[model samples]
Target: MEEELISKKELLELKGISYGTLYRWKRKQLIPDEWFIKRSVPSGQETFFPRDLILERVDSILNSKEETSLDDLAKVLYGSPVEMNITLNELVERKMISDAARSAAEPFITGPTDYYGALTVFSIGREIDSGDISLDDAGTMIRSMAAAEDREMLRQGVTRLYRKQGVTFCAIISDASKVSMDVSSKLVLEISMPRAAAAFKAKLLPNKGEEEDE
Candidate 1:
């Protein structure tokens, strides 16, 4: 199915952001160039964006711009392998991961968690929080994600949960577009790592109008 799109004019008005701000974000690489889909309109050429993706991205930017520079925000949104170690407490305090995820992941966690480790826990936590996956199934998912040799793949790959014959399984694939599942298995959930990373980073940044305690 073709993606639902919103025109540039509509986006600007709906989001209450000026064209200059939008273009500035584009120049800073915070908003990807490819997302600007130009098409022929009756009035002339017009630009558009994937509706849901652009809306969420703009909200993330607006929420984080106060606490983070556009460059740092770009790095968090588009850069690969964010090099940072975060303690479990820090993750919770920063609102990067939910309490449900923390509870489900604490036993498996050893010490300071890296980006992928935190993402794995956060992803599983989301499933558990949503009541989609049981805590027992989360263990399997966590182990599978952790066992991946190329940890970087988990950074931008797709994570899927499947159930077959009363057993749960997890798989990570780089291209979500080409996913093919077994006929007998029931697909439970699929999380886009890139989107998850964006949301995570947005959460990591201090909320707008909120000051950090010294």
Candidate 2:
């Protein structure tokens, strides 16, 4: 499904931020370049953003800007590598993954999981929770992503699930633009690892004073 988008003018007015501030945030990498989607309009050209994503991101930046530097916030929002060693139980306790997902991933996890591993498990669990994919198909996704040698690709890649002849297949590509499937296969799900990781980080490690009394 195509993501709902909001134009630059609407976003600025809705968020009550100036063009300079929005562009400055873009320059600081707080907002990704891909989010600034430009397309030809009747007047000439205009920029649009995924509505929900941009709104949430702008709110996060606005709420944290007073306390966090833009560079640090960029690192957090952009999914910079951070050291994390968490157990599967801890993930559930933190509401990062559903019990159903943890049960599906538990047998595969031999020891403590890193951030990316946890993120992958979380993604699988989410699909299962949403009834988008079955638990068995999620296992296939886990195995495919786990076997990927390119950690960078896994870190910033998009995971796609496909079904052919009742058999499930998984692929982790650098981006959604790289997704290619045969005519015989049907694309089932596509999850962005970076976006998932960023959300996970925001949940697992909220900014200081986020939970404090104002």
Candidate 3:
């Protein structure tokens, strides 16, 4: 990767804060101090950083400023020199507006679905209810996913979850779905378990008759 550096002047312009405040923040160690290397410049010496590093440092301020004191903001945003989840909760507990209006002191958290990453498959099984004629028509099909091919099939399966039929809710318990080998690339056993159904199902059944798949 390439380095991202910014001169002291550049940082000031980007921050739009006065030199006095900058020096004050420096004294407080809100940013890199010793790391702020000085280099030769036309006007003698100038402090700078690789632009990316500067941006990274700025991002360290997980908690943004609003009306709170700088100390409070840093403490809430960056936690202590030692981090604990509770420290981040302080700003929010005080109801300081760091993000939006209502989300003033909230944590900036995201989830797995919030990001796109490699998905993991635990186990593959079908939901076997004495209903759904399709179950009897085809003994069971199985497709195991441990590679890119499996993920793609999973995507298709998840997409069809709302519209398709292979992964249907079973009447066995409060929460369970019927699954089959028809939509998997895994073991070809039509065993139904508690519903935490897979995203999609692929048809590779041994039945001689062609059954239109979802």
Q: Give me the candidate number with maximum TM-score.
A: 2
Candidate 2: residue 99 Cα off by (Å): 0.6
Q: Provide the lDDT at 101 for model 1.
A: 73
Error of 1 at 89 (Å): 3.0
Model 1 pairs in collision: none
lDDT of 2 by residue, 73-166 (tens): 8876774765567788978887889999888887777588886788889878878998998889888888887678887777788899988999
C-alpha lDDT of residue 106 in model 1 = 73
RMSD to the hidden true structure, all candidates? 3.4, 3.1, 22.1
Candidate 3 weakest lDDT stretch, 10 residues: 199-208
lDDT string for model 1 (147-208, tens) is 88888778778888899999889899998789778899998888878767766665555543
Best by lDDT: 2
Per-residue lDDT over 84-103 for candidate 3, one digit per residue giving the tens place of the 0 to 100 score: 22222332343221222112
Distance from true position, residue 197, model 1, in Å? Answer: 1.1
In model 1, the Cα lDDT at residue 182 comes to 87
Residue 6 of model 2 has an lDDT of: 99
The residue ranges of model 3 lying beyond 4 angstroms of the native Cα positions read: 56-63, 76-79, 82-214
lDDT at 97, model 1? 68
Evaluate model 1: give its lDDT: 0.81
Candidate 1 residue 65 Cα shift, in angstroms, is 4.4
